[model samples]
Target: MRLFSLTILLAAVTALAGCNFKSVPEPQVSARDAEWLAQVPKAEEDIRYARYLMDDETGETPGTIVVDTKQRFLYYVLPDRKMIRYGVTVGDEAYGWTGTSRVARKAEWPNWNPPAEMKARWPHVHPMQGGPANPLGARALYLYEGNKDTLYRIHGTNEPEKIGLAVSSGCIRMRNIDVIDLYNRVDLNAKVIVR
Candidate 1:
C-alpha cells in the first residue's frame, strides 16, 4: 500500500510539472524611445537587471501589476498564465507598504514635485522640470485607492544602479528603459498589488 501511494503521488507531481506554459514576449521599444534609451549609460554587469517572461505564480488575472518587495521584483501578469518579470527597487523597511491600488494616472518624463514628506526629509529638494536629469526618470504610474491618492508611485528612476534593492522612500522604482516599456504595457485603471 505504501508503494502504491508513493507511485500515485509521483504521477500527480509529474503531471503538474508537465503542464505547458507559453512565453510572452516583451513589448518593442519605439524609435524615439530607443534613441534616448541608447543615450542612457548601461548598468554595470554586477548591478544590471534582466527582464524575462516567466511562468505566472502570482495567481492574479492578466493585466495586474504585482510588486514583490522582498524579492525586489515586479511582475506584469500576461494572458495564458505567463508574466513579464522585471527587477525593481522597493521602499526600505522604514517606509515599506503593502496594499492594493489602481493606477489612476500616468505621465511621460514627468516633472518632480517632491512630496511634502520627502521635502521634510530632504529640505533641499525642489520641484524640477522633466527631462533625463529628473529623478523620476522616463515614466510615472500613480497608484490610487479609489478617489484617494496613496502617495505611492511605481516610477522610473534615474538611478538604475539601485535596481533590485530596497532603498526607496515608499515608491517602486525601475530602470528608465524598463519603466518606459512597462508604461506602454500597463493600462490606466489596472489593479496593482504590492506585497
Candidate 2:
C-alpha cells in the first residue's frame, strides 16, 4: 500500500508540472507616453545601485504605497504625502485581491517555491525553481503583517504586456526593469495599500 501511494504521488506531481503559459511583455508605442524601456539609456551600476530620475519631484510626498487595481498603478507615497505612480500587472480579477500591508523583505533573483495549496490546484504546473525563467523575475518585496508572512509578494515579472492586465494568481508584478527601479526607491518599512 505504501509503495502504491508513493508511486501515485510521484506520478501526480510529474503529471502536473509545467502547465502554465506565460509570455514576455512588449513595448507599446504611444506618442504621449514614450516607451519607458527605450527612454532609459544604459548605464553602469551594481544593479544594487541602479538609479532612476523621477518624472516629477517626490521630495514632498509621504512614504506610503498606493496600488489602484483599475488603473494598474502603484504609487510610492513621497515625503509630503503625494505619490509617484508606475504601471503594473496584478492578479487576475478572479484571483487577485485588495488590502494593506508592509514590505518587510526584499530579494534579488528571488527563489520560488509554489505553496502546497498552489501545487494541489494545478497538479501539472511547474515553473523554474529560480532563474531568469522564474515568474518572480529580478526582484521581490515580501509583504507581511506583524510577525507573519502573508505569502504574497510585490515582485518583478517578465510579462510587461501583462501590465494593466488582471492575470496573476495573486501577486503584484512589475516588469523586471521597473521593479528594479522601484526596489531602489523603497525602504524596508514602507506601507503598501492595494485597492
Candidate 3:
C-alpha cells in the first residue's frame, strides 16, 4: 500500500509537469503590438456599422473597396442591385480615387511598392516587404479589370488612426482588425468598384 501511494504521487507530478506549453497564435503580436492593439476597436454588434455590414455575398458585386476621403462605401452590386453599404474614410479629398476596377487577387501580409507615381508624390516609399511598419498591414486585395491592372488595391494599414482619414499614399487602407474582418469575406476575381 505504501509503495502504491508513492507511485501514484510520482505519476501525478510527472503528468502535470509535462503539460506546460502555452498556446501561441501564428504571427504573434509582441508587447509593442499589444499596446498598439489597445487603440483599434474590435468589431462589436452595437458598433457593427463601425466597420462593415456583411450581407449574403455574391459574385455579381464581388468584393469591397473603401474610399478614405469622400467617406463612401461600395459593395459589389450583384445581378439584383443588392449592395452592402458601410461607412468609410475616403482618401483625403486631396488624394482619393477617381477610377474603377475588380479584385484580381488577395494577399495576407502583402509587400508594398510605392508606384512611380507615388514615388514622385512621397519619395519615401521604396519597394519593401510588408511588415508591422509597412503601409500595407495584414492583407491586400489587388484590383484589375479584364486584362488591365488598375494599379489599385484594398489593403490593411499600420496606421490605425488613418482608417477614417485620406492620409494614405494612394491605396485604400483599412484598420488591421477591420481589414482582417474584411479579408475573410472576399475571394479572388471579385469585382471592386471604387468611385
Q: After TM-score superposition, what is the CA distance of residue 82 in candidate 3 from its true location, in Å?
A: 7.9
Per-residue lDDT for 40-124 in model 3, tens only? Answer: 4444322222443344343444344433246544343323434444434456666666665667788877788778888898677
Give the local distance difference test score of model 2.
Answer: 0.67
How far in Å is the alpha carbon of 155 misplaced in model 2?
Answer: 0.7
In candidate 1, the residue pairs with backbone N, CA or C atoms under 3 Å apart (3 or more residues apart, or in different chains) clash, namely none
TM-score of 2: 0.66
Residue 147 C-alpha lDDT in model 1: 84
Q: Whole-model lDDT, candidate 3?
A: 0.58
TM-scores of the candidates are 0.82, 0.66, 0.62
What value does the lDDT take at residue 103 in candidate 2? Answer: 91
Query: Per-residue lDDT of 48-143 in model 1, one digit per residue for the tens?
Result: 255767689899999999999998889999999888888899999999999999999999888999999999999999999877777888889999
Clashes of 3: 12
Candidate 3: stretches off by over 4 Å: 1-49, 52-69, 72-87
